[model samples]
Target: MSDPMNVLAPEHRRLRIGDAWRDAASGATFAVEDPATGKTIAEVADADVVDGLAALDAASTAMAEWAATPPRKRSELLTATYRALTERSEEVARLITLEMGKPLAEARGEVAYGAEFFRWFAEEAVRVEGRYSIAPSGGYRILTVPKPVGPCVFVTPWNFPLAMGARKIAPALAAGCTTITKPAGQTPLTMLFLARIMEEVGVPPGVVNVVTTKRSGEVVSALLADGRTRKLSFTGSTEVGRVLLRQAADNVLRTSMELGGNAALIVCADADLDVALDGAMVAKMRNIGESCIAANRIYVEEPVREEFSARFAERMGALSMGHGLDDGVNVGALIDEASVTKIDELVADAVDRGARVLVGGERPDGPGHFYPPTVLVDVPDDARMLKAEIFGPVAPIISFTSDDEVMAKANDTEHGLAGYVFTRDLQRALRFAEGLDTGMLGINRGLISDPSAPFGGVKQSGIGKEGSHEGILEYLDLTYVAIDLPGPARCSGRPACAPAPPGRPTLPTPSRSRR
Candidate 1:
């Protein structure tokens, strides 16, 4: 077997522009640390605005030819890439665990989830369809063709590094759009290594480019300003997403923002406690609770709050924490010390606001950025964590007496991402399913993401979807074509007709769009 540490090989740590691998024009580089140990694992080229623009130019130059490639050929390329990614799942999964700090088992799941995008989009490539319809106006035929949106920019996040990049890149490639991806600086290796896989799988030069840099604001701003760039897809905090939106607005660029969320998990009175506890663990602790869809504010009906809280807290307290690469470790470190500080402050504020910590709430004393699983009860509404994403393995349970009150409080926030409800009552579940102001609802299940599902939120949470058929739509635009039929044949105008002359309008030949 190949060494797992091979991910840090010199050849794997560089910027990929067109068909070449090299350093930034300024010879700048940055350190990539293993979140589990807070130790430097690799130094990768830190792309500046110079590198970003060069990558964009390469994508623009390769756009038309790639867009013109037959859909079947594109589909074949994506399939090959998917097979290659799956074949090397262990190596890629290790990089994810080392860089992003999810448990090795969880990282393996992410590897499979990431590769699934390429496989799913491969089938979708041949399924990009247009429609033929009769126009309302007589003598005219109407048709619509979907075309590549042109060069695109994808700014991905640290959590779920592999899947996040795959979610954006696979669909963009399947839709025939050339792209330049800037993975988050914290976890750039996964994308960098994926770039190598793309080249090995014979993806044409410049069709897909990868760049990483600490100067994100400057680099991203340049890409958003490029006249040739047609779309922007970003996955990150709402504060940064807003900045990107303003920058993209200046160019009137199409954008897909999968921003932040403060999702609520509701446990109704009729809920099965066993089922609720199981779902709560998965919903609240997955990726150490660093998910946009992770339940941040868990509301329980007054009748079952105590029972639910006790069982849930026991589960949280029992989770084993250690380095991600260690066997049987259920939770891993936060992305960095900053994340540790934020989680600490939130727990402190809640404790100050009359909330009681039932179990672990303190940060562990260690070299890693680790926080123990904590459960806080009697959490007041005024607590700050309720309004923003906790992004940690801390659960705050608030008891409520009525459904209407709970619904109003749940929807009060600007975010409308994912919500969870554990109810055995059909009527009640259906009511909350339609009532909750989130894009996705988990009526019984906890893990909501699926390869074929349309994954995204509404309102401030996000602007567009990222999975299923909608995933491909973000990189495509539709153009309408109309044909006006000729009037009845009239050859009674003497030589004036002259076969309608070369300049005149005659029988129209069917001209099919290359798309």
Candidate 2:
């Protein structure tokens, strides 16, 4: 059967502003190609600064009304959106595969995973609670309430397009903040379709806006300078994240950054080889190894290094590779030719530095931007793959002698997003888990991300968390209110009625500052 995305009408691929579809200010369009086939799937409107400002204005206008909407009402709307996404899961999944070139099955899984965020946060919305505390002095009460931060700008990346966008948008919307989603130019169609779903599911006009632009810097600058967007939630490269942080500093915008990751997968001598292999394969090669949390470095204990390397290379070599739409394809093409070039460069650097290629390394000579699932052994310390984020289907393995050596090597990078350890020894697992300088750890499993758990990183990986109960708080502001009630009458000669209790220390008098 032909690809579903190949037949997308031009109207189905326009900029979404509030409840309407529109053209770019410059009347320019950019083609979104299928990375698997190297074919142009659709041309979306290329939003400029003018279109970006319009989106910001729409989100700003909707912020007040959306924030005032009751928590239950917002929950209901989110639930409706969730249902809509679930119903159109196949369509959205296909779109994702066509644009970003993950396997169709993985793309479908992405849709399901992405929709879960909305469902989870729908339940989280009504559960947003305020705390009330009675003063020990017995006259005043303090209430801490959570309020929406205001209009937000979500800058999402192309990798795991649907899931990344959902992670940011679901929480922001659940917290009653209007959002202007700036989806990566390569994968805007999926988000545009989601915007359509939002509009159809009775999301009030101007509550959600999506703008796609090749000129992301200009658009982001405009949004930041406008002063209306109070929060900026971004998921992309650590370098771009730093740039965004500096840009946002001028406005002091509240930011939630889920940036780059160089996750380490540690295989111990006593680990279950089958489980370890399966987990490592999934962790390293999921989404063709484009994920930020994908295991980038593999450190195996010296005792089992040879056995593990042989089995891993054989399995990786045996896996199927083709276009995303093809059946039984285990891996798909990289997002673009640039990714292909970079992956080759990194592999060559590693091989030149004494790394041994066990299975695959070179890019396939084909029409698509395809790279084979590669495994390397004896990778040197100075290899570029060891230091850089290899956002591709290349797995480099290193051998370690001791627990301390492995731990030190695992935490050697600037990124601390995610890490994995495979060991049956409970004490060893716990020690490594505690010692690894990463935000999230998988003791025996390969995957770490879940809707119910907080997803983020430390060091240069990112700034704040996404998902879980804490996720909603990133989009909210804590406001404290003190209510003063009538107190006991003061003594005639004293300044106030209250005195020190029998065993308690006397409170210091707050002195007034002289002008």
Candidate 3:
């Protein structure tokens, strides 16, 4: 028989009800596995429709009370949660590694970045504001303010479990909205650990409930149907993001979606080849290239294509691929076996269409879902790898003679989430920065996803921004309240407010708004 479930942690913690954790009514359990070793790490409760409904009901019951609490209190609660998370960083990191197979170092980074969301949004809690204006000829005073968007459904993906989960949860809580989180079934341990931490941080139970289940569609449908879930936050593939958007639309719920990306790395003729190669290696190989912002395509100037490809291949070959927890293991297995198959099909199709496989292009014969780091040249624009979001460690490099041509090619795909350009020419770099059809760009660097910077995409990438002040506002509703000082008539829809009084200490008609 296979190894017994090694979940040392409890499988079913009390669902956060009112002020306490309570058992699920369904009493169903499912096992979470370590993808590296094909072993079960934990058996978590499988949240069915019943469990999901209960969570929603709990949040619904607690929404008014939580919303009434002062913003300072909300910020303080998130502050406590962040402190708890930092203090238990090691423990949570271990859980992430155990369940998701991300490296210990990267896992630690996820925890730190996850906590940053809490800290940043904690500070943003008080920034929610309303503007004051004078109504034109209404003679009435209006008061408008920003308020919590009520209950939200947070569905996070398997990759970057803790960070993605924290991205959704911290903001909703900071906005004084109760939430129900659904972590990917394959990796729920880290999220469960976080839920426990939130409880300890004095978050009122039922303020946040996490459920792990294979029946995600059913649970999601139930939450969407319930009028109480006013907003939905999701981070995953574009296809799934679309489905969620449609479902959310059925109930007219607000949404924040961080979807898939087909990011391109354009290496100019004068770029620092050494720096570009090093950064591309990390960008293409980090998280085994499972990241949405990872470099998927490389468009090098014809003058330097040969040298850059050769040097890039050498470095890629030097990478050590093994288990995530293994020391010096730079590349780890993909999240699942099916993803391995998909990567294989894409690479094979590209090769069949005359693309040259420079470094890697196949999955090694192994027990785990491991695909070799792949690099391709002469990749046709029609190749699936070029147009589709290959969520794996495959870089398809195509040569371009002109900057304009490559820019067109890079923006050819429907995805406009993230892109990269490496160049020593300041003028060219500025032009590319202004022209690249993407929401975020990296110049001479591969770093994206900064907590202080807003992250989201345009076109098919999804709607609304996440991160910075824009991210926090996703959980809030803005209302403009116009207050007309107890006075006479003002301008009536004219460019200049009703002609200012005739030199009798006449005041401007409050043309612009004041906070």
Candidate 4:
């Protein structure tokens, strides 16, 4: 079979603004490389400050019409988009592997998972409702309604490129807001392909605009500085999130951040060892550990720590590493050489601080940015790997005696995106599940993210939720309306107006029409 990457050809490689494909005003472009081979696969038009401003202007112009669209009509469009995405799943998955290194199977799974958000939010669009209440004085009624917040800016990351973009864009559009998305430079091709899909699915020109650029700082700054963009949603490192937050403060923009995480996988003594091992492999190594919610720290109860560590090391050692397109390959390359250097540095520091490397640790002898799946034991708390988010294929194990001790260690970090606990005891599971400070917890499960559940973190991890019904609310504004009733009986400060008999008074039914 021919390579899917080579077989597919994208219709447009330039900025998508309004109704057409156009080049950057400055005529700049950037090369997107395949992480597995370090080869420039394609050159994408790099939007400049002028193009960024134009996208924002277009979105702002479209906001009024989109917001006025009926909820059911919005649902119909999203449903059509969901079907379109599902039909082209294979092509999009291949594009993901070509642009960002992840196993082809995993990339395929991401496409299906990403499409689910569109389907889920399509159903959610029509269900968005408000509340009505009778005033205390009985002369008026109060109606609370949800309105689109207005134009939004989505800044997505490279990891899980298709899914992350879909997760943010689908909800924003469903909420009746226009948006301009700025995808990471490393993997903008898949997102650009998605923009084409949106256009093909009958999405209006300015309702969805995608801008790819190497000058991310300049573009992001231009969008944030514009007062018309009412909201900004970002998914990336906490450091960059902070910078975006400062820029967003200029307009007091509404922001939703899905930032960094250092999640802990706790394996109690009573856990099913075999099941625990499977969970560990999936949690720590999925996406080559590039995910923010990937298991970064492992705390095993003392009784099973050694046994678990040995089996884990053996499993890690046996896994195959190669290009994502290759059959039977279990791991892929890091995002770039800088990521490779950071992983190596962290492992070296841990080993120097009395940590023991049980399996692979060094960079592989190869042409691409590949690193062997590494396992470490006795990693000290002071080691950088334990202190920071390790976005690589490295698993560090720590042994603890009791649940109290492990819980303390797990909640020690500033991040609280997601965590995992493995145990057969129901009471103990509930105890830790409630005690953990993270936003989402997995009990005996490695995978916690889904379109039906709310995905976000507390504290410094992030500000708001995504993927659930609440996620749509983040893009909406609540407005209250009061209506005064007319008649001599409804008039205030009139002695002739007496309270109605309490037995059975007919109240007017509220209208269901969209205002």
Candidate 5:
């Protein structure tokens, strides 16, 4: 089927590497299909090891030059890039909607969120700070500074193509580290479009290269194994994250992974019923419930379980599901057949295990991969739908009585990326906020993916942080330099050392080491 909007009228572009666009090795191409229509929207290059090597080399050459450029200059470039993206956001949004099957409104919001990363990180470029210290007595002062960690290889998932790519690429560039990015083949158009926008906005070639490919594992392995890659940023399933971790370990390379999430929402007994019911409907169904941070499991207090369930069911039933391009559609399809199958399997497993179907179940009768917003009640603790991350428009609700019980149940999953707590009682809110084992928590709302906030997870959810000051640090290194004003320099062949003055400590010998 043809694309709904042939906005991408220009000829297909090749992968970006070293300030130039080049075709994939052997001229291999992969078909990119739009999930909403199950149609081949475009064919993108299937980047292989050869392409990966070229990208890495380009990034290596560009890193030092970019790092040495003034921070203000970097900020201005990023700002310009952000403006360009904003100007073309609607076009980008249509591309995302066409490829990912998210409603047009949600697609537009994702584009805006992606652009925000550029804006926020552009400011972060000038905010890096270092520490200054005084010597023990009257020796010399010590200074600490931050430096970019060279080139990084970034791989983002299909669920949130534009935002995820922005999350990694914006920070890497802002920190003065060049990047070679690989966007998921299933939904690469939005990001590819962004790369074009960057070029138009004057982001010099070689500094930020993007490649789209179907062979994720091979490309990722090639990137991680290369010694020149200073850092790796990945967002995907836990299984893939483990493999990347081991590969990065072999080279002793730095890695930041934002993997799977089976987030929990603890609805306390004293929570505001109206607010809880309203937020619950939106939190569990956002992105058609495909978000890694989407509230998958809801643990409601037994006392208010009945009322909560009723309100939740009413609100959920009101959600409209249809094609993303349709003006009245509220939720849309699971990316494709695979996702639809996965959601179906999980829902079936829950039903067979005795979970009550509170509302919409089974696939929506349509040509697309549309699934209705479903809510499962009386879910067994061991059900796959409850135990695993359900990346679909399904919410499985469970009941709990005590605070301790709910917290334990919430923390039971192997993954802990994000958690939500809704309570009017201040003490309970504070306690739950502090006690949730996830990397991030939302006290009353489910909004946790702020650009300024640190985003990541603990346990099997993922490694390292992805946003805010912590994120910049992941792409930077700290170095300490000490200059001795009164102490003599050690001879090239002589044993070193100046004994420190009265109460002063002596300086350690310098060894040339590269991080």
Candidate 6:
């Protein structure tokens, strides 16, 4: 009934670059729509190549100073920002629900999850430990120092906008690196607000910047081409990831990509039927099934397939759907009409392949981009849904017989982001965990994401890890130094230093990019 966007002031609806919150240089603006009702909620500054390159310029100018700051001071600043974000969780949650259409309760949980990145990286800032080891040659002592990878550029997706930005920005700042980030065009408000919070918590001007733009390819290409911009971290589709990687090739820039996924959930015959059903709900329907790691294929053993599919279909049919801001709504709107269309096509394709819909299979006539919670049984292997990520509220359940057969079918896809298995026997659980061709696995439980653990994907799914200590490493470069044990005691105390070794060797790092 009310303007949900009243949660954000007019000042926060602009691009955050350097010390100014202003409109794009091109004077272009785009209206962001509310998916729940297809209403224009806000008109945001639409950045272009000029704004993006200007943001990069600011970061390059601030890089040396920010990287030279002491680790403890950086840690304190990040911690303060984390606290500041939590204080405004209610407002931030409202923005997320308004922009992305996730339930308000889930939006609050995202705020909590996102803020923890700042705190987690704050603790990690002071702990960027270097390594010391004796050289095998015995002529020199070897030590490696970790340093920031310099100014970085991040491209975030619309889903979980706050968390994705935080996951990238937190570690970059904690590692003493400056950054320029571009949020998804559809949902940039959270990141704009986050930039304000970081500024209030004492983030130096130009240390962090947010750019919202519809011309992402033009903007990102300019940033990547700039020699000063060192790394590019992106979270989106595998197709887009390949495009960005190709752009990265010309400059030889480092990249970290968390791309597409076709996750599978397997339930063994020995599993508790109730527990298996519950795990399926989480793995299938979290974020209304608009997740990169959301279970796309569900395989149940022959003995329990009937019972599990019946209960699952019943539960899926029972979910409540409405505007995310409404109370007691379990399922929220899809991102947009394109999302609804894609989900509908995937389901239709499966049904054409002889799959039977147990609950819902048709689109509703309404304003919002809403899809009913649907479950289909006997999903054929040749269906296109099995080969791709069905990023919606449709569940396609398939029956399996043996571990070998199931594993072959599960690993058949080109994407391998996450897998889940529920079994009472430890041996069977371990077998699935080991055999699954995925970066992360959930054993006997559905939930697997944790701020303290490493989160990433394998194959075309992603390039590097995103959480825990490994997350910080993405923003850092290691420099190995050798001290000449017998050759370089040649310090006459003239300049308070010893003479360097005769000749230095350049070390080659294994490239993560396929090119």
lDDT of 6 by residue, 1-515 (tens): 45556766888888888888989998999998888999988899999998998898899889999999999999999999899889988888988999999888889988999999999999999999998876776668899999999999999999898999999999999999999999999898889889988988899999999999999999999999889989999999999999999999888887999999999999999998888899989988888899998989999999999989999999999989999999999888999999999989999999999999999889998899999999999999899999978999898989999999999999998998999999999988888888889999998788888778899999999999988999999999999999777544345777546554568554577699846
Local error of candidate 2 at residue 122 (angstroms): 0.2
- Preferred candidate (lDDT higher): 3 or 6: 6
TM-score of 2: 0.93
Evaluated against the true structure, the overall lDDT of model 1 is: 0.92
Off by over 4 Å in 3: 1-8, 11-23, 135-142, 482-484, 488-515
lDDT values, one for every candidate: 0.92, 0.90, 0.83, 0.91, 0.84, 0.91
Candidate number with the higher lDDT (1 or 2):
1
The Cα error of candidate 2 at residue 183, in Å, is 0.8
Give residue 36's lDDT in candidate 2 (0 to 100): 82
Clashing pairs in 5: 19-206
Residue lDDT tens for model 1, 1-515: 23455855686689999989889999999999988888898999999999999999999999999999999999999999899989999999988998999999999999999999999999999999989866665577778999999999999999988899999999999999999999999999999889999998999999989998999999999999889989999999999999999999999999999999989999999998888898989999988999999999999999999989998998898899998988899999999999999999999999999999999998889889999999999999999999979999999999999999999989999999999999999999998988999999998888999979999998899999998998998888999999786454347768875566577677767679733
Per-residue C-alpha lDDT of model 4 across residues 1-515, encoded as one tens digit per residue: 34655533544788999998888898888999999999998988999889999998899888899998998888988998889889988888888988899988889889999999999999999988999978777777889999989999999999989899889988988999999999999999888888888888888889999999999998999999988889999999999999999999999999999999999999999999999999999999889999999999999999999999999999999988999988998898888998998999999999999999999987877688899999999988888998789999999999999889999999999999999999999999999989999999999999888998999998789999999898899999999999896432435646656666688586777788936
**Residue lDDT tens for model 5, 1-515:** 23534655434356877777678886988887767777776887888888888899888888778999888988988899889888878878878888899998998888888899899999999998898876677477788989998889898888888999999888888889999889888887777777878887888778989887888888879988888888989999999888889999998888899999989998888888888876776678778899999998999999998888877887788888877878888898788887888888999998999998888886766577888888889999989977778898888889998988888888888999999999999998888878878998888886778888899999999889877878788889889988665554335553354444598676777778834
Candidate 6 at 293: error in angstroms? 0.5
- Which stretches of model 5 miss by more than 4 angstroms? 1-5, 9-12, 486-515
Worst 10 residues of 3 by lDDT: 1-10
What digit string (tens of lDDT, one per residue) describes model 2 on residues 1-515? 56676434567578788767899989999999988878887889999999999998888888889999998999998899889889988888888888999999999999989999999999999999999977778788879989999999999999888899899889999999999999998888888888888888999988889999999999998998878889999999999999999999999999999989999999999999999999999899988999999999999999999999999999999989998878999999899999999999999999999999999997789799999999999998899998889998999999999999989999999999999999999999999978998999998898778989999999999998999999999999999999886575346666466566589787677778733
- Tell me which of candidates 2 and 3 scores higher on TM-score: 2
Tell me the lDDT of candidate 4.
0.91
